[model samples]
Target: MIRTFFTAVLCGLLFVSCNQQQNTTSEQSATQATEANVYGASFDAENVISVTQLQDAVAATDSVSATVTAEIVESCQSKGCWMDVRLADNSTMKVTFRDYGFFLPVEDLKGKTVVFTGTAKREVISVDDQRHYAEDAGKSAEEIAAITEPREELRFVADGVKLQ
Candidate 1:
């Protein structure tokens, strides 16, 4: 019968439409999940400079906003509040979160490459602050006590950091 054929065709079309919609929804969810997995501030990697460039700028006493990509040598073990990013010559810069807003995962960041977008400032870190940071890094008591003098270093306050 013509009616039977038409009804079957309509049902087939409806089934196909529903299947396609479901697939689309599933794909969107997966994409969103992947994007949400990235940590820190969202940053464009194109303008990122090398750690050596940042170091040179610091040596020249240039305080400016910069994007630098470097390997994380260490992170604060207590709360992941800060990290030490390494330069090409094995120098390290301390990176802290902006406005105390966000912290990285302490254990998961070591040896990972990250792009930081923020300002690098040259400042003297006091003995107390150095010892506190050393303790937070899980350093031994002797190591913490070794921080007896304030030292000038490059400190970066990152508005956003993206793991590469």
Candidate 2:
């Protein structure tokens, strides 16, 4: 009789432990969902650096991994494939998603704040590409024709983004 009683107690304890574990998992999922408007990949919106800090880092290194908070100066009106953000130096840099894995909503998100995880690098954009981006931004024909010179600028490839 004692052996049967002990067996029953062990089973009850096991059931309770499993039930608690399941509840914890569900709670975590709920928290993540309510955290932010996650896009591309899910990441905790932490360790965020400023766009000014990003400018310094980009100038100092060829590439750096970071999470940055910045305001959108412009976005791709055509496909939301990329965005331009103002940096500390009063210049704008283009930000694209890594591997075309995700895209932002096709709307004018200017002045909206966003936090994203990505890598930044410096590169020289070709004249053709510059014109292409201008076209995507719905520039005037005169503006598109004026993009005759290649420009060097900072660029970012974000694997995850959180539109705040």
The TM-score values for the models, in the order shown, are: 0.76, 0.78
**Scored by Cα lDDT, where does model 1 land?**
0.86
Candidate with top TM-score is 2
**lDDT tens digits, residues 24-117, model 1?**
9999789657756345666666778998888888788769789988999999999989999997788788999998888877575788888889
Tens-digit lDDT string for candidate 2 (33-131): 785477788887788999988888888879999999998999999999999988887789899999999999999899999999989999999999999
Candidate 2 runs further than 4 Å off: 1-36
lDDT (CA) per prediction: 0.86, 0.91
Q: Measured by C-alpha RMSD in angstroms, how accurate is candidate 1?
A: 6.8
Where is model 1 poorest over a 10-residue stretch in terms of lDDT? 35-44
What lDDT, from 0 to 1, does candidate 2 have? 0.91
Clash number by candidate, in order: 0, 0
